[model samples]
Target chain A: MSAMAARSPFRTDGTWLLVGPAVIFLMLFFIYPFGYGFWLSFNPAEGAWSANYQKFFSDEHLWRTLIVTFQLSLPVTILNVGLALPIAFQLRRKTRYQRWVTTLLVIPITLGTVLIAEGMLTYFGPRGWLSQFLQLLHIYDGPIRLTHNFTGVVLSLVISGFPFAFLLTLSYVTGIDPTLARAAATLGAGPWDQFRHIYLPLLAPGLAITFCLAFVQAFSVFPSAVLVGAPSGPTRVISLAAYEAAFEQYDYSMASAVAMIMGFAQLIVVVAVLGLRRGLYRGPVGGGKG
Target chain B: MSAPSERRHWFYSVWSGLLLGLMAFFILNIGLMVAAVVTNSFGRRWLGTWLPEGYTTQWYAAAWKEFQLGDVLWVTAEVVLVVVALSIIIGVPAAYALARRQFRGKQLVMLLFILPLIIPPITYGIPMATVMYQAHLGGTLSGVILSNLVPALPFVILVMTPFIEQIDPTLESAARVFGANTLRIFWHVLIPLLMPGILAASLLVLVRTIAMFELTFLTAGPDSQTLVVALYYAVFAAGVRAPQSVDAMAMVYMAATLVWLLIALRFVNPTQLVSRVKEQPAH
Candidate 1:
């Protein structure tokens, strides 16, 4: 080390003091509770260290909630990301009306899950406007069962999740330099070729990140799964399992166990998506922010 | 990328038209859903009818009286304000430090900030609530504020780091060279430059904390319930009250969020919310 460096207190400088309060706060609140929860999950009220895991895996009813959650979240994530890509791609170019459209789409996100559930129950209910309109128009006279089921929960997820997916995807789509496509066009390449050879590779990493985020948001479905879904039936997601264990049955250890498992499940999907992203083209995300 | 009209193919126009129609249909459904809630909140006895038999504002009055909305709104305001202020106080400095320094274990600190964001709240909310109860802070306003800070603080740091990095570091150095202490430099030189970012972060946090559900829900008590949590309870505890009243309550919650959301949008782009995911270290 140089004599100047040896004498200077780089690590203990006053600048580092700026970060001290936040680090201490996170340790006391965030990391400490996470570690404490992990330890607590193992030491159940009465049983062996592995009892919660044993019970969770062995009981078909308990473990099945994990599968149910995956069923809901996976599809919702795919749907949100898939639908968002096309729309966002189309809207990638700067326009006078773009902000207004984005703002309109953001309403569902600001409205939160509970409001969406409440709105779904009334608007998509059997006696709701949708049913009456369909019946009057003779589009389909059969019964319309949207609420109190898996489908209702999916609808709520889409309403809330789509805007998020759309915005993120829009940012990615807009980041690509449009001139690349135009350059390809000048070389006699068609739109499909330009997109396939250029845009797709650049978009892959962003899409993977988008998918992971959307999946994580959808995976922890609590309020919608209850308000608009059959809580005891198809929509008994993992978060619901944890909520019931903690709040309903008053078992904090079991709840922590369930919550840990929930985090583990989300981590698996995120890891898989990010791992996939590793192989994709990684250039500067924005093409000069044009 | 807009092609000249004469050069645009007919097929392309048709496809664009179809896409426009689809967008309209989706927005229409969302509009109808919100309209349905607003209509139901004011409607009288009507079932299986295109319109309600009549409309009245009694439900709003009933919801206000029965749900103790006054208390809920007050609690929501307190929680949102305190969380915003605390997050800013703690987050801005950390953001500045991270932006300006190259310390050991920087990746670990970045990871610490990112985890709370990518990990869904329910996963940590349960454990945090458990610890809060153990500490005798659960079911209180403080617990709600603390739990919310977990996400809000990281958010402020992530958003502000980029902002801080954009500011020329020489400004700080110049202030120091003039014999100004750290506090003096921050107060006079940095704060003015950081005011825009601070405003944007606080506004976004305000909107988020008002709408945050899982954290506040897991930690709050009857008296500490925010509007969103209270709205959840109003719907969750079924058969004890009128649906219209609950809808009315939902409307009130929507209005609160909508007002802040509009104000937030004026200051911050909506896309900036999740675009920070791109800022994660590539390693």
Candidate 2:
């Protein structure tokens, strides 16, 4: 598409003109507001530049959101990517069930977090079908308490995140040429060895990417945390804390600061995982990696 | 040697079966959860029970009036259509530029397009809302539509770029060589080829903005509320909330989203976006 010799009706300046509108739009709407938020975080309503920062750091309840967010995000990311790996590996090859499973998994992405939370409130709640069925079997003495706690929030994240993780990892895994694995087997490598030496190394970068994405998605836990999880307790993740600060408390300064903190936390993990990709299989995957 | 290999084969089979079983359970649980919400919206008495005692459509009526969903749906339609129209108008040219022309700062531009997608909206939504308030757009239809355009435009660009790239450049050149002008080529030559991509991108924009709870929630006035945001208020707002009414509203949201998604999926693969981002050069 970008070959030097290929001619277009427009000049190079015309090409630049084509790209201008989008960049200008984002600069106005996305970048400017984001910069404004970061700047606003430093100046609070009643104090110096660091007032909101100090307020947040001093208030243990307020600052703990960073930790709570990560606590749930890390596990959810691991579980989603971990579970998605083998399933994607198995379903990478075309099968009768593959398309159906993929579509079923993607049901949540379209369904949205708010709707999933709504569903979980009914099916996973105490005395709901899951609990009642378990009770009928005498598997437990009490109703299955799935909501209003850490379990509920984690379930919500996985329900939404797993499909995402699977879709991304399936693309990554299947992107690799299967002939590499077959070649390894022909050379006396078994499934275990083949996966360890070939698939793991090749899949590392994609896994890192998938993990970061899922983590970011999980870290921004809001509607589900408030709806299904204990928003005042176990699932008071960072986004909820920010929402409370801005809308509930009407402290835009403090809310801006918390939002910056949330972005910073996500950035740290994203940078770390992105760095990990350097040590993975760096050669072009299919051409030379096998 | 043969014995060890045979045992390993046995273990692999068992593990494969376990993995398959886990996927089946995951699918079944989500299916039942969806069924629960759908059924409960109409259930007469589902409290403390595995199944509803009876069902009725009265909740749907109650939900429609109680939530004032008719107006919300209208507002949602307005916001979605404007956002889609704006995103396409802004994004298609950019996609063409990125696909066809080499330039400096292109990588920077690419990264900028993705940042909104990667960084959660809540981080930016609050300040954007504050700006909207300062500018007196916060509680209006324009504000919600503007806030939504931030993500929706870039999304259109990202989806459309690959589509633009896949088109044979020679076709454009052929149209040009045939003396067709820019607008003439775009309308007569490029648009027909680009129609599927444009349709997919715009449909996704519609789906996304409707499901976009955070940005719209932050900026919407009472008169400007979208369905997902309205559903959120129904459950979480301070009052004695009816669980069934909330469920019913959620079903409405679900129906709207599902219909658009089913249509969009007909044109694009779910993995399409992920693969496009992966293929895009970051710098």
Candidate 3:
């Protein structure tokens, strides 16, 4: 800390002033609420500290929702990252087509969840296009059930999350020094070898960060779940459950407890990610342009 | 070698073709979705076809009349503007300190600011709403605005830090040498250099705020509902046969966001902004 003081002209007072606003803002809105929420988790209404947690664990529906949340998130993360890698690699060609591909990829970020669900209802619903197409081909006797189930929710999550993962990985891939790859080629290395030794190592940190980001995005999913996800099936994510508790039942204390548990789970996961990759923060992948 | 070069050319063409095909598929999907909403808004009926049967603007009229769509739009705009402005105001100075100065627990502070981003909104929304309720701020516009600050503040800080760090500190020192005080130096030298970053941050914040549904939905009551929240209620609540109205409202929301995105892309490079935080290597 003192080392930083020597380089900058700002005195201690001035630096504190500069950083104070952001800290206070985060503390008031983020940390305090988080702390209060955690406290509530321990002290449920009309019970001991562990009582609420015990109830949560005992409830089959709560456990089911948690499992569903994980089921939806894990598959979406894996699928999104898996699918995005090839598109990202191909886009590194830096051709005109690559530019168009990138632009098109950003289109989904603007579409809100409500619109996405509405579109799914019309396009993939029982009487929607897919069902009609299948029926016309004599592949099915009745309408195909795509909505109101796990299939619809997973599809929606994949569609919304794929672009985000793709964009993140694409940027990382392009940032790699092509010179390194060329040098590997000149050294009698093949494409796979070049990728394994040079590209993979550089991409490791980016991949980890992108996975965490994509996972969190999928985990916090609500709109798509409620809109397309069947409440009875394995699609009632923890977020949806928490929302119902807080608003529908007006059980603020219980809702806070649920939220706190989710937050803590996320924090632990992030800590694990950071711990697994020690040298991720070493250098900027893409050097800042002056 | 010549054969390999030819092979590479063939590979490139095939790969490019596939990539473009996927991109076009994605674009077409979004286009179809928008077209459906727009067609539905226009009172067009489509039973079992890709396109609609007929077209009219009566749904939009009905949606407007029934939902007080204009007021919802106003609330969204007002909240987004206030959130963006407040985030920039607080975030810029803090970003400068983080980038330029060394502080104890700096890493911890950075992590703390970024925590909101990692934790899903649902994780925070519940507790935050409870705290608001206790404070009697729940269901108020101010509560919604404050909850938004949780995410928006970190975003502004993360985006602006690199931009501020890029400005050579000597320039500010030079200004000070010319008898300009700290305040003056910041006002004239730093502000001008950071303007583009500020604009880019504002645009990002604006888009985020507009699309924000979960937090607002949880905290806002009927009077404070945003357009997205209103649309959510319209669809899920029982005895509400207003799918057409929902489609119409969604189209309006989509149009507003699309316009903002176009404007953002025109002024700020989306790639640059998205990658700003990742571009900063942790020390």
Give lDDT for model 3: 0.76
- lDDT of candidate 3 over B1-283, digit per residue (tens): 2113222446657766786677667667766666666766675677777666777788888889888998998888888999999999988889988888787667888998788866767788888888888888899999888888889899889888988888899998899889997678779999998888888788888887887788898789777888778877766652476667777877888887777776776655445434453443221
Q: What would you estimate as the lDDT of candidate 1? A: 0.87
Supply the TM-score for candidate 3.
Answer: 0.91
Angstrom error of the Cα, residue B197, model 2: value is 1.0
A1-290: candidate 1 lDDT, tens digit per residue:
43433443454355558887888888888888889889999999999998998999999879999999999999999999988887787787888667777888888888889999999988999989999999999997976999899999999999999989999998888777788877777776665576687777788877888999899999999999999999998999899989888999989999999999998988898998888777565666434344
Backbone clash count for every predicted candidate, in the order shown: 0, 0, 1
In model 1 chain A, which range of ten residues has the least summed lDDT?
Answer: A1-10
User: Candidate 3's residue-wise lDDT over A36-97, tens digit each?
Assistant: 88888787777887776777679988767777887888888988987787678766667776
Candidate 3, true inter-chain contacts retained: 0.57
Stretches > 4 Å off in candidate 3: A1-10, A136-141, A188-190, A268-290, B1-23, B272-283
Best by TM-score: 1
List DockQ for all candidates. Answer: 0.58, 0.50, 0.50
lDDT of 2 by residue, B40-141 (tens): 899998877767899898889989999999999999999999999999988998998888878767788999898888777887888888878888999899
Candidate 2 structure quality by residue, lDDT tens digits, A65-129: 77888899998999999999998987877666887887777678877888888888878888678
Clashing residue pairs in candidate 1 (N, C-alpha, C atoms within 3 angstroms): none
lDDT of 3 at A266: 64
